[model samples]
Target: MKRLALTTASLALAAGMAFAAEHETTVRMGTEGAYPPYNFLNDSGEVDGFEIELGNELCARAELTCEWVTNEWDSIIPNLVSGNYDTIIAGMSITDERDEVIDFTQNYIPPASSAFVGTSEDADLTGGVVAAQTATIQAGYVAESGAALIEYATPEETVAAVRNGEADAVFADKDYLVPIVDASGGELMFVGEDVQLGGGVGMGLRESDTELKASFDAAITSMKEDGTLNEMILKWFGEDAATYE
Candidate 1:
């Protein structure tokens, strides 16, 4: 009788574990599907980029089902707070100001340099009209750097402002501007010294979602340990981009 009861208990436990695995938690990942190489809409209009792939991997590792959600960059945080999405996987940098409203996973990408792209090689970086996406670190830097700051809602618009001569240069992450400058055919070139801003990028979650944050943090740590995160970073950002030491 004792042996039979023990076998029945073990079977029941295995069945319960199977049921739990089949019904994993679903998490919505929000991104600004506009920042290329980081996150963007592909030719088929689906969200596709480094973050999308990385977010999916993290979700799988954490045994969570993920749904991608696209939000405008300016309102990304507000929407996350309002429950439009469970977490922000957008290439958001970790900063004390942002932490006041939401918690963040450990840094995924390392701190990167921001650079200025201008029509002319000699374009004035300071005391000149500079364009930056609103609410970005580059925008804040431009505003306080003695430059006449012009803010745009989208990163594309900031680049366009420089092309149209509305602004002398556009200030943004060097990783974002590298391909654009190379594709500009000499129309746009990097000017002035590179500026490092903000801490490394990480996923943003509401402070209440401590469990969710832990899952992602662990997934990120695993990727970093096995060199998979560095591989993905280089695949997207190229050889010159920073990686874990």
Candidate 2:
């Protein structure tokens, strides 16, 4: 899951109240179209990934017309607060700090671990320069864990830092790192213990949009009850990924 430290002003109540009137039939879903396995631009250059597929199903279940919107991770929340989108279905983790800015649906993905990947298996994680996406939970963890932290604007750049010898390791979601490591052949490998952080992944919405929130929440619960949610998780994250149980 992704967790960005938010510093923007809260959304106005007027905007939240206007949501139902302005888009009763349609919902705009904002995402960072870079993070793979969660949300990404496919070969056809359209948003396509696990979240894209699951979000469509969620919208259909809630009977709401939905459209996709792409934004930089750093500005994703601010844009939502300014009415650029109706909801955020990116790989954003549910955290108390974020809850102060926008409401979150009950977790759609269970809590997962953060991990470090480096070019070498013996990389010095405690003292080496570590790279992480700016304002992410992994970045914060790196800063406080005694490693010299380097921040990148995108997740790919963080991985690149390790490849280019600019960083000793790159820390991020273990699921996000898994495919990268596998594709690297022998170039990259996980270097440290998996660290658990954040609660889980969820949809971020304005506080006043309680009706829409309830609709989506009910849809999520229905999916959980019928086992579709678990099926989707395993489909994207493989058999070892966490589930609702």
Which digits, one per residue and each the tens of the lDDT, describe model 1 over residues 46-151? 9999999999888766667789999999999999999999999888888899999999988999999999999998898887899999998899899999999999
List runs of model 1 lying over 4 Å from the truth: 1-24
Among all candidates shown, the one with the greatest lDDT: 1
RMSD to true structure for each model, in Å: 7.7, 7.4
Q: Model 1: how far is 94 from its true place, Å?
A: 0.9
Q: Rate the local accuracy (lDDT) of all candidates.
A: 0.88, 0.86
TM-score of 1: 0.90
Cα-based TM-score, every candidate: 0.90, 0.90
Number of colliding residue pairs in each model:
0, 0
What lDDT, from 0 to 1, does candidate 2 have? 0.86
- TM for candidate 2 is 0.90
Q: What is the lDDT of residue 129 in candidate 2?
A: 95
